[model samples]
Target chain A: MLTSATILSALLGGLLIGSAAGLLLLLSGRIAGVSGMAAAALRIADKGPPWSQAAAFTIGLPIGAAVVLAIVGRPEVTITSSVPLLVAGGLLVGFGTRLGNGCTSGHGVCGLARLSPRSLAATAAFMGAGIATVFVARHILGAG
Target chain B: MRHALPGLVVGTLFGAGLALSGMTNPARVLGFLDIGGRWDPTLAFVLAAALVPSALAYLLVRRMERPVMAEEFCIPQNRTVEARLLAGGALFGIGWGLVGLCPGPALAGLAFGVWQSWAFVAAMVAGMWLQRLYADLRDHRPVHFTG
Candidate 1:
């Protein structure tokens, strides 16, 4: 379903994210660190990300999609997995975020862009695990 | 104060775009990684989506004399190659290759209500926890980390 058109659509998507991060810095004196926001969302009471912030962040995701769909149309998806595996995966990521003190966005996008040491470490861990998982799944377990 | 709101708004828009573009969907991501099989080409799009804005941002920031938060532009200080760094990188690569989602895409995926994205995220957190334990045990030894 993807072609050069899809690539253009993606560039647009990345621009949206980079633009948001820039705007956030310009307006709020804050970095659009997903890990920090997410951690706050999970750990803090109402103190977590402002309801508006969370809502906006969540809503923006699909809105970005709407924009793409308007331009590039749609893409097909293929997956074969059990619900149990899915649930297990979500749980593991949540745990990793807590341990790492940030998610990829916090580190990879916002943090690394800012030249943060902590972010670099966090991103490295995130990618390392990702690669290892792929190797084990594909080569060892032979699972997709 | 108001400027900050733009980031939040932009973030939402970005996330939504990712979903609409199929970047947030693990299947699309996995397909891209499946070079050995069908070899879907969506990942290329995702990287492109990320690269352009980032490059522009770097350019813009360079033009600015100062950032909003600090007097000087942020720059990386650490330049080390150590064991812990290698270990962490390895872990991240494995996780990414297996699931086709990383931190940026994972958060975006969370909004789409994809079960697999959620799972990848959960496991990612666990890996961080294990790292922390090792760090504490090592008493903050020279742990290598990269961006």
Candidate 2:
């Protein structure tokens, strides 16, 4: 299932992602944490400085994705989870990202790059929990 | 106008990266998480690749007095390892494992024009709002720390 093209795509995509994060930091010194951006952009958080940047980034996420799809066409995507599970997942992610102060983009990438011990701890915590959840749900419970 | 332009461009690039890497697909994400089963190492590669530019940028930032556009580099200053951080991360991991959709991918999924993506995003937004409300009620200050 894995091909050289796929690996190349992953590498290219990853570099692009890193570039976006680096660009944002270089230009404005903001962490490209999607959850934080969404909270500020949606006006769910108290309005303050640079909220507009968050709004722009949030809007651009979908627009940028659409642009890529237009150029490259859609890839194989199968959402195995039901609607209820997605909702549950969404709620957990939303609350958790805020409570922890970052998501994959924040703690997993930028934080680690910056050599923040907090990011390391947070990333490890989430990865461990994620792996455990999958083990339990798929192996023990026999549920997908 | 100046404030928004960089964010928009960078965001577009970010989304394109996610799409190109196939990270937007929940199934692929699940494949990565399900190491107990048929594992896919693509995400590991993505992570390693992503760290390259990011690490260099951070290193570069150290030499520069300030960001090009911003007056100063704004980042989290707190280093205290709070229990809330671990608990919250764990909770987020559970959600991510369940659906293999984090905030970024879910938001980017909007471009897929899939109902599931929309649903996940809506719920995620609501969840964020709920957390904001909870924090507001708990303390007068807003939660903006990223440490």
Candidate 3:
């Protein structure tokens, strides 16, 4: 089912992500880590340009998606999990990202680009965990 | 002031990228994660494509003395491969596998106005707050040792 169109779109999308991250770093000298930025925006103790910048970036996420919807049409999303499950998952993601100090964007995309050993280790750990969880959820638990 | 515009622009582009890459779709993301099942390698392509530009960007950064808009680069300084990193990454991976939604894609998906996205964001924020509280409590706890 992996068609050429799918490959092209994925590549194009990734290029955009990389460009955006690069732009942020080149212009503002900041890592394009979504969780870190979101947390910084919410943290009351943090002040000034960094806070405002983070808030702006957080606000822009939805706006960009809106633009994509207008231009390219909305992507189909179906959540089969119950609300409770969803909440639990969300909580873990939020907590883990903060505790780990990065996520896919920070560690996977940007960190890998820089060839940082820590990021490499984090990426491998998360990928392994993710794969194992998916196997258990889909195969063993039958909770697709 | 200057930082705001660039931040917004970068965020917008990043969100757009996520949407275009099919990351906004939970099913597709789950498919990518499901290695034993009907695994999808589209995300791998995305990662590879993203690396090209980002790698070049780092090279560009190496040439610059400072960011055009900031006084100094605010890169992460910690290089330790601590237990926290591994544990937190594992936890995050499990959550991501369960929901197929990470922070960036979750935030970008908010444009759909789905209750799931809203709920996830709310829960994520609360979790972050809770972690901060725990960290604070740990810092303030009195050390007791038995001689």
Candidate 4:
């Protein structure tokens, strides 16, 4: 259903996301990438603002969702994959984001905004890979 | 504490955006990915909306001497495209397609208290730890001596 409300929600949501990233950079000198921040939250050895700040940001992710839920009610979320599939996907995401140095937010959002060639390449690769995976899973494998 | 306060605010906003944009919904995300099917272009709009302000933010950052809260910006310095980048991206994409959930949404979904989100988060953390371990081992590998 491609309604005006959907479009408005997406646009507003995107603005909020961009504003958060922008503010993070302007205020804290950090890229608002979830994977990196989450990893930093687990870094026991690293000290200083980076560690505590990362931990705080990570904690806030869920809180932000909670706030949205409080206002707009719970979102409709469907989990179709089995436990094994979910676990495998999660592991890959975690490992790949770390190895690749960023995920959608870091590479797709901030990196593209910066006009970094590496980010462009990474984004292309991931998007291409995502399209191929979907094709295989849905068309070829008949999973979807 | 001051530094962390900013992080918390940013994170909250980010999460709220994810939920509001419907990124937290796996079905919606899959709709976006399903170009061959009934595709949903909502995610693209979200991306565009996000890029506009973020691009502007970078422009603003260029004029500033330093962040308001930090001494210096900790931006990524690496420029070269390496094998790791391509491989990792490919792997990440595959995972994203399978589940339609990325790190941000996965964490945000935790607020719903669903078992699947919890499982995914736990596995994700394990995967990160595994990567660190692998990197450590590779870096510390003993050099071989040729006869």
Write the residue-wise lDDT of candidate 4 on B114-147 in tens digits: 8899888888887777777777679995432211
Task: Write one digit per residue (lDDT tens) for candidate 3, span B46-139.
Answer: 8899888888988998999999999988877678999999988998898888898999999999998888999988888877776666666788
Model 3 gets an lDDT of: 0.86
Candidate 4 wrongly placed segments (more than 4 Å):
A44-49, B141-147
Per-residue alpha-carbon lDDT of model 3 for A1-144, expressed as tens digits? Answer: 688987888899999999999999899988888888888778622322387788899888888888889999987777776788789889888888877878999998899999988899889988888899999998998878
* Model 3: chain A TM-score against the true structure: 0.93
Q: Supply the TM-score for candidate 4.
A: 0.95
Off by over 4 Å in 2: A47-49, B140-147
Tens-digit lDDT track for model 1 on B92-138? 44445555665556766554455665566666555444454565567
Docking class of 4: medium
Question: What shift in Å separates residue A121 of candidate 2 from its native position after superposition?
Answer: 0.9
Residue A137 lDDT in model 4?
89
Q: Which stretches of candidate 1 lie over 4 Å from their true place?
A: A43-55, A66-74, A115-118, B1-4, B32-45, B58-98, B102-147
Candidate DockQ values, in order, are 0.29, 0.64, 0.59, 0.58
Model 2 error, position B43 (Å): 1.0
Candidate 1 DockQ vs. native: 0.29
* Candidate 3 structure, TM-score to reference: 0.95
TM-score of chain A of 2: 0.94
For every candidate, the chain B TM-score is 0.74, 0.92, 0.92, 0.92
